[model samples]
Target chain A: MSTTTTAPVDIFTEKIERGENIEPRDPMPEEYRRHLIRQISQHAHSEVIGMQPEGNWITRAPSLRSKMILLAKIQDEGGHGLYLYSAAETLGISREEMIEQLQTGKARYSSVFNYPALTWADIGAIGWLVDGAAIVNQVMLQRTSYGPYARAMVRICKEESFHQRQGYEIMAKMAAGTPEQHEMAQDALNRWWAPALMMFGPSDKDSLHSKQAFLWKIKRESNDALRQKFIDKTVQQAEVIGLKIPDPDLRFNEETGHYDTGPLNWDEFHRVINGDGPCNRQRVEHHVRVHEEGRWVREAAQKVLSFEF
Target chain B: MTKTDALFHYCLRLGDDAVILGHRLAELCSRGPFLEEDLALTNIALDYTGRAELFFQYAAELEGKGHSADDLVYRRPERRYYNHLLCERPNVDFGHTIVRQFLFSVYDRYLLEELGAAKDTRLAEIAVKALKETRYHLSHAADWMVRLGRGTEESHRRVQQALNDLWTYTGELFEMDDVDLLLLEHGIAADLHTLRALWQAEVKQTLDRAGLQRPADGYMQTGSRKGIHSEHLGHLLAEMQYLVRTYPQAAW
Candidate 1:
């Protein structure tokens, strides 16, 4: 343990500067762990609650294949939340506490999830854009400074790619199908496009968490940078799928080599994040209902396990 | 239409297969033996239903049928449906439910992979997407198969008994008649002969892992592929089809 002659802060500073991953056992500032837990837990809650919108379409999916993919994607999201919560557990936070925070509305997930998955195309759009943007964020998080979170991201990124691909394929088929099908695809994209942009979160200038998060290497890049990257990648992908992205002002400027998009509706974003969106109360209420309904099942499992032990 | 139109019918057949199985599983919605398993079952059921919707929608388009997915699912009479009898059978208990899911998921896994190679673009694309989901379902069911099969004497014995009782129904899944023959000619449906061996290998391996003996595979049942069903389908449809039949214009 004493083999190195480096001072504590100096070693910490070097690790942070080099973007080396920090483990639970590693010595780091308490603020770093606390911040990671806060953000990661919020991310976990988002994944968990995110199940609702698409879940509504589970029984109503127009085809067996779509139902299966949607189910897998939702189940995968639950697994993802478990992984993230487990990672946060390593940071010395309790799962119950994080869940409590989520219930109390003290934590925040991605605001995009607050919107409902209203149709089959909404499922496609979510997979193509919402999950697509999430993959972008998660792929970067795979290189994040927390070892467990990074490892979790590695697994999540692999599954999320399939989700994105299936979603894109869905949109491709619809775009090439009859006019009605094309309209459904366009409608889904219109509804989801802006929310997808908001998923990257507030711009760097307005983001209070970005600097400390960036400095600690908890976040790989600034919010604005990630948002821009997502925008650039999505624009071309949308074109290939033959769907109209809702942003009327969205364009590629050859001069700056950047996408020029319309202003983000921060007001709506804030309202949704603050639990004022159309589906916010319904989503949470449903989550609670299901949880309560499953109480007996959890008890039965516990009962069976006890006998085995 | 050439045999290729059979591909369209074949897609509907696959869709109907999943939808029926999903509906059967959904019957266990609040009755799961345990919570996690309950959620898992419903999740799997939802997956099947979603897959059915995709196949049905595509099939409707291919057939030039004016029917929407809802219309195909709710408006069809029982005799017009094409699902195997095994999927429509009621879940007797946890043992029976798990056994059904375990066997069917293995079959689906193999079948979907073969369908992934279909010459028809829509079928191929649908299978490619569905194959991934089926793989997960197979793995999940396999895990439970091993757990329940090896966990306790009661679990082991009950699951084995369930397997034996349910064995006959499996034969219907491979029964290829006019629709199957037609789809095969068009490269829409997978070659069932090839899929059978893979399904056998997967189920056998999982049974072996769980320390469960293979129930004798003799005395397999048939006729369900030809629109024949067990007594359960009528009861199932009575409940499931009731809402839409009664409401007619209900939306949520």
Candidate 2:
């Protein structure tokens, strides 16, 4: 019965509109709290799911330096996932509950992860396009209206910038290498480019959620706006590496000063978001299988944890 | 074998043990039970791989042929790899992997400590460089074994099963051959036979605290020194040597 109270909601809304950081103990609106939990947990889930595709290549990485780099990068993703899960816990949801949602397929991770990384160059493409897009979103997220989530993003964004650069460096080297290596770089860019753009989510017009989040300052920018920023910044990077963007419509309009043109395959994006992507089932199934298998291990850890020090 | 030949073979045993175990652990990179554990396991794998590279480099120099580190790692035949049989065992499950890691880390730390004090400055330097990482790995794996062993009925059963399954391979860690004897005579290697008593005592204490049982009087499996391995090593080498085998001297 007490959960139905809404008088304090107005004050919380006012604080958000004024751009004040929302702390965990603040008497926030029920919707606000739910929204924060959902968004934060989904984000946390994304970091965890994101590790798989890149992690698959660690043993096969062509060089010692590459193996170490990929391992460290993937490790950073795990650390980021842990940090985000901790932030989500501040909203009164347990990590187990959040993990359950992800396992049960009720929660959503980024659809970009639903694609497979087929080659070494794909790792580079992921770091450049995928992580590059993530940084843009996370940089905005760092400025958003939640104390703990914002703090988490600050730490994540710092690491993410390095990830973007590492990928680009790989691409730069590959594109300059032999013909086969250059082709591999180009192939990865072509395959991953559209998926990277769709990572920003649907456009502002068709978007079903997050507008109210914007008014509350939980979302600092529109999906389409962020997507545009990703495209504008990434095109030049592709050009520098001698890899062509797959879009024929990609051109700079001097008037709008934005990279414009190209129909994003929103149908494919929707399909992937709805669990129809190439790796959607495998990704979710693997996560579920591992989680299930880990029950005994977790149980053991819990038992030890309960013993008196 | 000449003294140099023995040193070369001795270094290969060290290098191969690290490389093979590191390869097994690397197979678990993205597949950990959880994010933190994934990070933890991979971090350990990285350390082992780094140490393997150093050991292989030293071995290549000791052999003093045209061989380089990668030549030792990628070009060597299956029979030429001299890793302990304990290291090449598959990571069947988390309990199995951690238990195997725990058992080996204890031996590894002890061996590294003795090697670090060797008369050969090169062996001593490499041992000192590697001992820090071995100690860290031992702490991590030992902690996990205790947790799983004392965790729950199911956890205890699975971990106890792993301990029993892996216990036989523990004997090979103390096995010595001509290479070991030669290196020991020159004060360039540890007395592994002596370290075994220390290792077994520590293991007994650890298992006692974790509420796990250790098998007694099992037929000990040995062959790493003889270059005989289970079916797992062949598969590991096939994948590990694929690119190298395909493109000979391919530079990434």
Candidate 3:
């Protein structure tokens, strides 16, 4: 609000509006710094937390090829987490601090991960749908105003395209497979459909952070816009694979040339995000346990790095 | 004494070792101490599974009973799995896992080298393809062994303890039975015991480089070659086969 600071703030905002990036060393508003750090770290946490559900299927993957695909996919999520965490670090927060925030439940990852992957078909559903939504959201964020986050988003979007396709391929096979397989695929789609939608976050009116984030060019699309895009593309794909999407109200809108769907359970979404989802506690607890148990190994590795070995 | 019989069994053993170890590593997928290491371990596991599939497919072909690879991996009882006991050992900790991988990779490297030169073109071709992966696995696992051993007091102690505990199972990696002997006579299989000295030397050298001592080798454990394994194999198989067994009609 100070006269002197207003000029620099205007310049920063103007650069973002002009479609240019703000480097880490550039003078940024404290609010902008905090927002970037929070969003980027949460993004990183989602990737890290995302590994658990898919990893559950790695050992039990029915085929050699599927097993590899699942393993590679989970590994990619781990890699994404590293990239995003490193990206967040450019905003001046340490990786340990962000991880601590996650561990203490002081911060949140994607609430979608709070749902358990109960069956192998869920993997297919996730790769196809969850990743599908992420791709839409990420494609937009690739133009984010922050340089490192934008660059990281570019790399992630590249890898994520394959993830969604691989997932769809699994769904395609199951849908064409035996009756039991078709049923499993349908069940997976049923369970995952709403969740994948929720990954775009709440609607515009309900998303408290969206206005500021959008103003800062951190998110190039509203949650609703990205969700609409994902829903439009995904509904047809489900039909092609002979799987019924869970949304009973889902239909293509001829007038708008977009898919119209049922209302989301914002209460359930809030509950899950507020630590009430089925796997929310389990996921956080697992992360905490690993961090605690891994302290010695990390310390040992660090010691070697410090040449104290 | 039939070549097909010995070759079929030899290939099954190789496939079994790969899949079993691959299963163990796969279990460590999300539980890795760190992200990069998690990816590294799973990448190696992917190689193991890939190698397993190749060997299993070849074995199924040699068996000539229309048995698919799934039957070999999922339908078999624990006692029918001929993986080296070291692989069947649980990944008790990072140190133990590293030591186990180091020992197995050393044996596997030399084994692949000899097999790469087999007179049987198909087996030789498979070996030549697999040796590349095995060499990489050995170097990665060996480097970890050195780091963990030389890293700190805790890592050093844990890794040395792993070496002592796993030393017995190490002998089984080089155990050759009549099936192997029969294949060796016709150059369809390499004599596993021939690689024992090289394995020992490499292991010793790696441990020494890590500033750790190799445990004295005595009372070597054997029986995996005879389809006998530790209790751990059954637990692994239970989880791995659950989907296939519970839903015989299921297709992944």
The TM-score of predicted model 2 comes to 0.93
The collision pairs in model 2 are: A300-B151
CAPRI band for model 3:
medium
Could you give candidate 2's per-residue lDDT for residues A1-309 as a string of tens digits?
697676677778778878899999988878888998999999999999999899777777765567777878988998999999999999999999998999888999999999999978899999999999999999999988989999999999988778998899989988987787788889999999999999988777655576788778888788889999988888898888899999998899999999996898899999988989999999888888888887778777876886642
How far is B83's C-alpha from truth in model 1 (Å)? 6.6
The interface root-mean-square deviation of each model, in the order shown, is 7.6, 1.9, 2.0
Shift in Å, residue B98, candidate 2 = 1.7
What is the Cα root-mean-square deviation between model 2 and the actual structure? 2.9
* Count of steric clashes across candidates, in order: 16, 1, 0
**Model 1, range B1-252, lDDT digits (tens) per residue?**
567477666777888888898877755543445235656887778777877888989878877858887678777777777787778777876778878888888888888888888877887888889888888888887776776676666677777888888888887677677777777776767778888888888889889887788877788877665666667777766655653565465331
Q: Could you give candidate 3's per-residue lDDT for residues B1-252 as a string of tens digits? A: 688988999899989989999989988887888778888898889899988999999999999999888778887888888888898899988889889898988888898899988988888888898889889988888877777877879889999999999998877777677898887788777776668888878888888888998788789998888877777788889888887888888666
Please tell me what DockQ candidate 1 reaches.
Answer: 0.10
Against the true chain A, what TM-score does chain A of candidate 2 give? 0.95
Clashing pairs in 3: none
Q: Give the Å error, residue A260, model 3.
A: 1.8
